[model samples]
Target: MATPAAASDWIRYWDEASSDYYYHRPATGETSWEQPDRWICGEGYDSSEDSARRSRAGSSLPLEDEDDVDAPEEDLFVVRASLSGPPPLPAGGPPPLSLGAPPPLPVAAAEPSSAQREERRRRVLGEILSTERTYVAALQTLEKVYMVPMRMVADAGAKVAIFSHADLDTVFLNLDVLLKLHARFLERLEQEEASGHFGAILSGAAKDIKGCYTRYISNYAQAEAHISALASKAPDKHRYLEVCKSHPDAGGLDVRSFLIQPIQRVPRYRLLLEELLAHTEPGHPDEADLREALARIREVAAFINEETRVLEKSLVRQGRAFVREGELTKVFLFSDLLVYGVPTGRGYVQKGQIPLGEGTRVERLPRTEHLTHGFAVVDGHGKGYTWHGESEAETGEWFEEVQRAVAILAMVARKTALEHFTAAKAGCTLIKFNHRDGRSSPRWVRISADGSAICWGDTKSKECKSMMALSKAVALMHGAKSAAFYRAQGAKKDRDWLCFSLLFRGRTLDFAATTAEGLFTWYLALAALVGPRSSEPILDEEALRARVAEMI
Candidate 1:
């Protein structure tokens, strides 16, 4: 058999059976013969349409070259046939039509030209191609089986039946590359075999695969290189198949924290609320109270959803009014609850400047102006939270209110995170919280039915992603600033200090760094500090007693 390099090099090829006799023919050399040796005929060549000229001895027939006709039937065979016996013969002589053979299979005999291969490739990779892996596998496997003739036409002296094996291997490898590679900038790298451009293509493919498979980046000149790299590492198709199956679902979008936040917070807060309400409620009936609370929740929910449907974009547009002069600010979830209504769904409030049209305008977010006074994010009761819209400067009797809000809101965030993690695993949305304003709620309160209390931070730290900092960020920024302003004028500072302390994880939070499992410890410490009367737990007589003993 011809080496792949030499076979592809020239227009000339020889009969492997007759080493000394070479047949210099067109790429597609066509002749009809019966029971011919296993020769790679000019399968791809267009046969001449002229009538076959027969050289017969009769005067009526065309005469052969008399000199060549008298020559003995000498076959210059290079490799002798391995068959042991002189078997069957037919009516014809030296031209070899004497041997009898059955007709060829239609699909096998219908030869494909080089142009046909190109057409097949284009058809297979068309725009509406199926991405279903199973279909891809079957189609690719079938293609490998069908390209036997083309392989022979391209490589003469190629083993007759075995030619398909090499063709199948190469085609399948190319398919693997085409299917797996993804890139932003792709340039086709098909080239002649001798120039060895496949090497360059392989290198480009490796970089492309790394970027596409690993991260979103610009890479790859052609897909071929990726196949070459994978081929080097895992020569067997099964290994490549395994890798393909294990890859992440490339078509789906990444799950963001928004959906996660709601689904998570809902169930966890429900459980915590159920536990808290069960312990705290008096055994004696209070149907009116539950009804009133449910009605209130409905009212908030409706208002939030309504504004969400109508004015969400306008509010988003006007959010820039919240940006202070040269001050950078973020949503501070509490602002979401009060001004717009719901971060998850909708809002009831319109986006108007503080002094009606006087505030700065915004077409986008990171609302900087009123940002300092919006909400706080923190962790309490062993979790994460956003303590909604309450200024930290709640001194002079309002101090008690800030403490109540902060403690409850912190528990809400923890439960939210837990609920989200759980729901994501289950692939469903379990919780729906409401956002609304509570102007009559002493300090500005925006409590969702769920436990999300978004508060603003007042510290110098501008962009804090910490749950604790977020819960109280608005208060820290606005209230803390107000507190400092007061301190500068010799105003009382007791309440502001307490708000800051509460946000810094209270006393338990202070000592929390030492514990390996500090989240629960902080919750216990905080619950103890907040005490039973304020919490008003509907405690199990036994559990409450145990808790009290532990606290002591």
Candidate 2:
């Protein structure tokens, strides 16, 4: 067994290395790869003719080293500065190069000694079987010592069942799913090992695990509610506790803790697969299967990340029931608001409303020696609601979900403020430029649709500001011409530069970008701002695409 720190290190290795994983959208029917050493700048870019030739040849751009195939998946968008820099060339031209076929695959490693590799594989299988057996034992303990006794007590006219049946159902359902899946896998794995057919079974391990994880995550919300209720709402739970505590087979463990074991075990698949991959050689028959499984399991982790993101946006599905202030409360979490409701004679009734914003705060409280899952939510007026969860996992989810929702609210507030400022000034588009109107050194300048451009000194110690009335301001892009900037050179004869001029009243402002793509973006944004409201100020497809591309 690894120490806690060692376990964390293993998980972090996969999490951080996931940057190399890229998902190809299915609809585009297009795929390409970019090497780290390549650049998008003029000197580093391939010629248009070469790009066209590659397209015609049906070849993908060189990808990262194939050895990284088992690395975790990457995000759809990467946030970083451009990798390209000024090329080593005289001002007039670039150096010649002979571009050829893509690089060959890396050489495979020398095979490990037979006995050592087989022993490692056997050890990995043993670990899997051991964990699976431990998990099965935990589930059996629940069914035998806990579930069976609870049913007996309920039959004897106790009110304990009323408050606990819903929770019991949830726990039993999820446990059943896990128990059957692992039991079958354990039998299959043992048989395969005996028959020396390990490759066949291991190949499909990831697909099977992926199916299980999908089901588990689907029931995550329900499981959380059930565990919370069991821990906090069970009436005279000491009766059931004494029953399980005194049982010979039971280890006197808290049932809530026992219930959370399966949830914790879900991520353990990644750890086990990592160990397996380390032992399997590149040429091993099971290597492809292991890689495929790793990728699929990584998808499961990715799904969790996305689900958390959606929770941050809003609780699209209704929130689960949580006991608050000694009553059942159903809380709906939205990016901008939280609505609390309680069961009433007629139906559920709204009990309170909390507007989450700049002033609202959600905090996780330090648990007491006895309570392991305490949290608090303080409204803008200082009114607070304290709550408890059944287990550490449940409590952590609540804390994170609320925090993410509040973060989304704060982000939306900032976005709204920016939009309002732009609307107040009747400006929609803005850009930064290096201005050399009169200063000896280039000054950083910000041009806005308010018919103005402000120039600031290198350290912003001095300022040059200009603005024009909306009625008189008009913006337009002009063709590139031979001109000397403060420090930049004039465009060469073969090169195309993007230059735009802003005219308002009697004053004029100029801006330039190095690439046509950027110039076109600025031109379109400015054109949209200056044009009449052909329809409305609401975001149409074009506006939405731009906003999503920029994120602000």
**Which is the leading candidate under lDDT?**
2
lDDT for predicted candidate 1 compared with the true structure: 0.25
Candidate 2 lDDT over 108-213, as tens digits, reads 2123445656667766766666666656666677677777766666565544354255545665555666667767776787776665445556557667767776
Best by TM-score: 2
lDDT of each: 0.25, 0.46
lDDT for each residue of candidate 1 in 1-552, tens digit (9 for 90 to 100) = 122212321122222232212222223343221222233222211111111222122222222222221222221112112243222222242222212222222232333333543343333222112212222333333233333333544466544333334534543334334344421112232232223222234234434433332211111112222322332333553243333332232111111111112222223323332332332224413323333333333333344334334433443311111211111122211212212222234533333222112121211113256543333322222232232234435221122323333333222222222322232222211111011110100111111222222221111221111122112211111112222223232212322211111222221111111111122222222222221112122222112222323332
Off by over 4 Å in 1: 1-283, 315-318, 322-552
Candidate 2 lDDT trough over 10 residues, lowest sum: 6-15
